[model samples]
Target: MMNNKKPEVWLRGELPGISTLLQPAAHALLQSKEEVFKYTEGFPEFLLWKRPAGRASVGFHLQHITGVLDRMLTYAEEQQLSEKQFEYLRNEGAEIPEIKIDHLTQAFTEKVAQAIDIFKNTAEEKLTQKRTVGRKQLPSSLIGLYFHAAEHSQRHIGQMLVTISVLRNQNN
Candidate 1:
C-alpha cells in the first residue's frame, strides 16, 4: 500500500522574507492554495451551484474562500472595506450562471498572492497592534487577525472539500 500524504508546508522550511511572526499564516495560505485546487479539480461544472441538504453550494464556498481572505487581510491592515470590496462581500454566495470554477480559483489564488505580500512586509512589532473587524468594529490585534485569516480560510476549505466529496461521490 502506498502512503500518499505529502509533507506539510510548515515542515518544508522557512519562507524567506515572510516575517517570522507571520510564518504559520504564510504556511497555511500556501497549503490552502494547494489543497483547494486538489479538491476542486474536475468537479462537475453542472453541480457548481448544487448544494446537498441545503448546505452552501460549492460555488459559494469557493467564492467565500476568496472573499473572506480579501476582507480579513484588509482588516489586518487597519482598514475598512473599499467600495469594491464591500460589493464583493455583499455577494459572497449569490449564484451567477456564467461564472466558472476557474474564475473563483483564480480570484482565490490572486488573493493569496496579495496576502503573502502583506505578510512579507508586516513589521514584527505590529503583530500586537490593534485593529477593527467588519462594520461592527470588533477589536483584534494584527496577529489575531492573521491567525483568524489562516483559520477561517482553512475552515472554508474544509467545508469546500466536504461539499465536493458529497457532490462527487453522489455523481459516482
Candidate 2:
C-alpha cells in the first residue's frame, strides 16, 4: 500500500508551502541571468540601442528588469528604496538608467545573487508576512515576491533575446 503522508521539506529555516516548486523556479531564474549575459557577449553597445525608431533599446529593457528586481528585493527586506525607485514602484512608467549591455549583465548577475541570498536566509514563516514596499503595499510572503521576480526576469530575458536577434538581422 502507498503511504498518504506528505514528505517534509524546509527552506530558509521554514517549510515552504510548495518547496519543490520554489527551489527549481529560483534556480531557473538564476540560470537565466547567466544566460542573458552569455547571450550578449562580445556584442557592441551600439547594437543594444540600434533598434527601430520609437522602440526601446535592448539596454533599456535590461535595465528595467534590474530595477524591478532591486525594488522587489528592497521590499522583501523591509528596507527603504530610493526616491526614484519608489516613484517607479508606484507608477508604470519610471525612468531607469541607460545601462550599457555589458555593465547591465554584470549588475543583473550581482543583483540576482544578492536577492537569492536574502531569500535563502529568510525564515519560512517570514515569507508570508506582508511588507510595505516604498509606498505600495505588498504581501509579506517572500515566496510570492520570489515568483514575481522570477517571472519578471524571464519576461525581460525574452525581450532581450528578441531585441538581439532583431539587431543582428539589421546588421546583416
Candidate 3:
C-alpha cells in the first residue's frame, strides 16, 4: 500500500475541509507520513544515530520533522514558540539510548495528525494573511508556513530514507 507506484497525492482530488490551495500541502504531509512509516519499518535501533558519510542521522530527521511541523504551525497561528518547544528544538538529535526508531516515527505520526486537525479549522480566506515567524519576525503567509511544513517534512523523510539506505548497505 505504501508503494510509489500509486498516483501523486495532489491528484487525489479535494480533501474535505482543507482550503483548495492548501490541499496539496495536506496531501503531501499525509503521504510523507505513510512513506516514513513504511521506510522506517524494522529499522535497527543501534543505527538510529549513525551519521553516515557526515550526513545527519535518521534520528535527527525523525525528530526534526515533528519539531519543525509544530513550530511552523505555531507560526501560522501567529504565536511564538513556547519554552518547552524551544527546548525540544534545541535537543533534536541528542543520542538517547531509549529513543528507538519506532518511538520517533510514532511521534511524527501524531504530529501529522495534529497538523491535519489544525488544517481543518483554518479558514480558506486566511491563506493569504501575513504571519510573523520566529524571533526575527520574518514575514510569511499562513499558506506559506503550512506549505513549508509539508515540504520540509517530506524533505526530512527523504534524508531519512537515504540514511537508512546507507546504514543498511554498510551492514551488509
Candidate 4:
C-alpha cells in the first residue's frame, strides 16, 4: 500500500519568513517537535524516567531538547543565559514525579516555535557573526548556534526513541 503520511518538514517546502540559509535548521526543529509528539503518544509517565541499559531516559531527552534549544538561541542573540535558564539546565533529566510526558512534549513544541520565530527574524547577513557559548566562551557564529540547536535536538530525539522503544518492550 502507498504511504499515506505527509512528507517530512524539509520536504514540505520553505517556511515563510525563514531565510534560505536557515531553512534546514528550521525544518529540523519542526521535524523534531513532530517526532516527539508522535513517539510519546500514550507513553506512560512512569516510564519517562526509566533508563534502560543505562542510556539517558526519555524524560532527559525531552527536557534537554527544550533546554538546549533555548540556550543555543540565547547565544545566537549574543546574550548570557538567564539564571532561570541555568537552573533549568541543571535540573534537566531529574526524576521529578510531578512532571508528565505531555508537559515535556509541550515545552519542546513551544521551544521549537520560539526558535523558528528567532530564525525568521534573523538577518541573513548576520549568520556569520561571531558568538560565544557557555562559561568558557567557546567561539561560534550565529549560523553555527542555530544549526547546533537543530542537529542536537535530532540527536536527542533519536536517543529518546530508542529509550522509549526499550522501555515499552520491557513493559510489554
Please report the candidate that would top lDDT against the real structure. Answer: 4
Q: Rank the candidates by TM-score, best first.
A: 4, 1, 3, 2
TM-score of each: 0.93, 0.73, 0.93, 0.97
Q: Which ranges in model 4 have alpha carbons more than 4 Å from their true place?
A: none
lDDT tens per residue, model 4, 1-172: 9989999999999899989999999999999999999999999888999899888899999999999999998898889999999899999989999999989989988999889988889999999999999889999999999999999999998989989899999999
**Candidate 1, residues 1-172: lDDT per residue as tens digits?**
9998888889889999988889999999888998878888888889999989899988998888888888888898778899999888778788898899999889889999999998988889989999999899998998988888888888888998899999888999
Candidate 2, residues 1-172, lDDT tens digits: the string is 9896433212233324335445754665676686686678877776766655556577766777778888878777777788887665454222333556667778778888777676567666776777665456644566677777778888877877877877888788
Cα lDDT tens digits, model 3, 45-102, are 8899989999999899999999999999899889999999999999999898888888
Best by TM-score: 4
Q: What is the lDDT of residue 148 in candidate 1?
A: 82
TM-score of model number 1: 0.93
Which regions of candidate 3 fall more than 4 Å away from where they truly are? Answer: 1-6
- Model 2 ranges off by over 4 Å: 1-21, 84-99, 138-140
Pull out the clashing pairs in model 3.
Answer: none
The stretch of ten residues in a row with the least summed lDDT in candidate 2 is 6-15
Q: What TM-score quantifies how close candidate 2 is to the native fold?
A: 0.73
